[model samples]
Target: MAALQIRQDYSAPDLRQRAARERDTRASLRLLAIANALEGMPRAEAAGLAGIKCQALHDAIQRFNAEGPDGLHDRHRSGRPEQLSPGQQAALKAHILHGPEPERDGVSAWHLVDLCEYVERTYGDSEWGLSGPLKRLNLSRQKTRPSHSNGHPAAQAAFKKGAAVTAAEPRGTAS
Candidate 1:
């Protein structure tokens, strides 16, 4: 196989300077490797000094030749596609924010299990699949503590006032 040639436009010193200024460790390594290659070091030795494989150095060289210094940096990777469409996600977000209808949803508040089931029934997706979308939407699994149905604010305030009064009153010594 023919040895890949390092671009002559960028000198070894220039590449070293760029490597020193680079924040990304991987990109810096690639720059260093190219610099070593530019200085007449063998491909395998150059890649080893950069803590990378010869193949990686070759790939970096190709990128550098094609796009110059900018090409040495990693390409933006588009990860796995979203399961739900934008409209569907928006609907889900709105549904979550508006809250579950007690009559229709049969729940006073939303829970992960409940939401999972709702997603399955409404979107035809599995119950397990809602977690990732919910996370992406920044919806937390944690729910607010439920208030007691029988609790009265007035009664609780009165009890607290009475307790405070009792606590403030000094106890008399036994005769």
Candidate 2:
């Protein structure tokens, strides 16, 4: 394979400064050492001391040479877009706090499906399906039912007592 030619723009001061205060300070220092050795010392020796392959060292050195400071930061990667805006999110939070409880709607409690449907229908927007609305809004069931049964002592006593006590049995024969 042909050896890659790279120019390192990192001056000694820059390498030292970056190496000193970074979160990954040691790694940065090692990278700087590799860069220094590549720029001043030797490629093989620098890459070996830095514990990295020559190709990786070459790439780092190239990046340092081109972008300067900002190259060290992670590149921006796009994420999923919002189903609703920040204002919508804040409004939804308010709705969760003091909006009419689900019980008022003849439902026992709020289920995931119910909440999703409510948001879609409330805004008169039919495009959003269950998942979109669900991701945008969250609701849970209310577990307010008492976990007990009442026992009636009067009924129990009535069942135990009767009016047949006056009718006594005949005495048994005795000597």
Among the numbered candidates, top TM-score falls to: 1
Structural similarity to truth (TM-score) of each candidate: 0.75, 0.46
List, residue by residue over 1-175, the lDDT tens digit for candidate 1: 7898777999999999999999998999999999999999999999999999999999999999999988887778998788678898899899999998999999989988898888889988775766788888998888787789999998778778445554444578554
All models, RMSD in angstroms: 4.4, 12.6
In model 1, what lDDT does residue 95 have?
A: 96
Error of 2 at 138 (Å): 12
Model 1 lowest lDDT segment of ten:
161-170
**TM-score (C-alpha, index-matched) for candidate 1:** 0.75
| Model 1 C-alpha RMSD to native | 4.4
**Candidate 1, 16: how far from true, in Å?**
1.3
Model 1 pairs whose backbones collide:
none
